[model samples]
Target chain A: DAGITQSPRHKVTETGTPVTLRCHQTENHRYMYWYRQDPGHGLRLIHYSYGVKDTDKGEVSDGYSVSRSKTEDFLLTLESATSSQTSVYFCAISRSGTTNNEQFFGPGTRLTVL
Target chain B: DQQVKQNSPSLSVQEGRISILNCDYTNSMFDYFLWYKKYPAEGPTFLISISSIKDKNEDGRFTVFLNKSAKHLSLHIVPSQPGDSAVYFCAALRAQPSRTGANNLFFGTGTRLTVIP
Candidate 1:
């Protein structure tokens, strides 16, 4: 297992509230990713960071944003939570300079919007 | 459009039997493929992978077969155990140097494998 941890293993919030999920890695990997897992949809990438202050949108980046100001932390925020945003969010990290390298994952954060 | 797809939503196999999970992709630019297994309430873990230049790669009980011409890949687990029950995802990436920061993976919908003992 990689030294990756995601805060707030589970959360419940109102539809219009703001929600922030944090991912921290001790390995100091250069690549980090955020994904949401839903039934029938499997896992969809929301955003990813290649380095500090360098991030890009993924297939399902709409309504979600990410920030990586330091090497060890990656944060995913929902500006205004929505019911459709309720899902299992996962954080993954992979070392730089390797395309086939494996990604280590955090336990995951399950969010529910009411 | 879904570039990577796992058509089977779920699969069942008996203990000690062979469990075969299938995946397909429509993009020809994808040159590297990987399989990940996920247990409920936990994150997905890397299982196996195959490069486009290779047809098959194996590790322990897991084996991944890639058919570039057909744009398909399959994961095989022999002597499947109850612990093997989980949702498996297939992912693909376009070949690019890591320094370029262009490595983004497209994932499949996943197939839930249930091994009945």
Candidate 2:
């Protein structure tokens, strides 16, 4: 389980509204990531954080932003929701700093933008 | 372009049989590979992984075979059970100069495996 939890396991919102999904971890892992899983795309990284206040963009980072102000928490925000943005979002953590390091995933949050 | 690809979208197998899921990648820089299994409405869980240095890695009834020369990899599940009927994803990792040791992964589209009871 990786001591991970995601808020609003399911959500529905209209386009143009801002939404934030929170990922919390009980373990103090140094690396945290946010990814969106879609049918054809599989899982694409949206953003990741290496340490508190340090974050970077991922492959499909458009329209999304992330913040990790604390070690155990990483938040993913959609600046303006779009129907295309509707997908299951996943949060993962790794102890190491590398991108290919073994990762543990949270349950996931399904967001629907109408 | 998709760096990692799972050509098969779905595969069916009978209980107690063997199931093979194939994955291919285009990036020769990728040295580490991983497999993850996901049930509907849940997050993917790490299954097994193989480094480019080895051709095979085994844990219990699951094994991953890597063919670096062909830029291919396969996950084999022996004695497939109905419980093993889930989506399997193949991922590859290469360190980018931008992020020293950070291991961001490139994932395949995934294959849905169904083990008929």
Candidate 3:
């Protein structure tokens, strides 16, 4: 397994409150990604970082934001949590962001906004 | 719209039987395809992949077949076992320039497979 860990494996937050999920990796990978998984939607990328301080929006980036200040840490924040944002958030890392490289995932964080 | 589509929501197969999962895509630009397996409450793990230039790729009991003309792909698991029961996701990659790292991939709705013991 890859040296990846997600903080707050499970969380319950009130609607309109701020929430941040953390992804920490020890592999020193260059690429880090944040994804949310929902029924019938599979896993949709919210944001990804190619390097420190470099990030890009993904398919479902509307209600989420991300930051990568260091090579080992990537954070996902829900500015103001909403009930619709309830889902499993996953953090992934890859040695390189190429078709030939496979991304490894960390244990997901399940967030519930009530 | 979903660029990758997995029509089946769930499937059941007897142990030792061949299990086939199908996926389709609408984008012609997709040049790479991959499958990931996920157990409940855990993150998905990469299973197998096939490039657009190849029709098939196999590793152990897993085989991936791609048909570019039909924009379809299928995963075959021979002698399926109960351990193989999990949700499978199909993902597609559109190759982009190397500088930008076009690793952004489109995923389909997953299909849950239950291998009966």
Candidate that scores best on TM-score: 3
By how many angstroms RMSD does model 2 differ from the true structure? 1.2
Compare the candidates by DockQ and give the number of the best one.
Answer: 3
Model 2, which residues run further than 4 Å from truth? A98-100, B95-100
Better of 1 and 3 by DockQ: 3
Tens digit per residue, CA lDDT, model 1, A5-94: 999999999999999999999988898999998887778889989889999888899999999999999999999999999999999988
Candidate 2 docking quality: incorrect, acceptable, medium or high: medium
| lDDT (CA) per prediction | 0.91, 0.92, 0.93
True contacts kept of 2: 0.67
DockQ (C-alpha) of model 3? 0.71
CA RMSD of all predictions? 1.3, 1.2, 1.0
Rank by TM-score (best first):
3, 2, 1
TM-scores vs. true structure, each candidate? 0.96, 0.97, 0.98
- Candidate 2's residue-wise lDDT over A1-114, tens digit each? 689999989999999999999999998998888999999999999998888998989899999998888998999999999999999999998888654578889999999999
DockQ of candidate 1?
A: 0.64
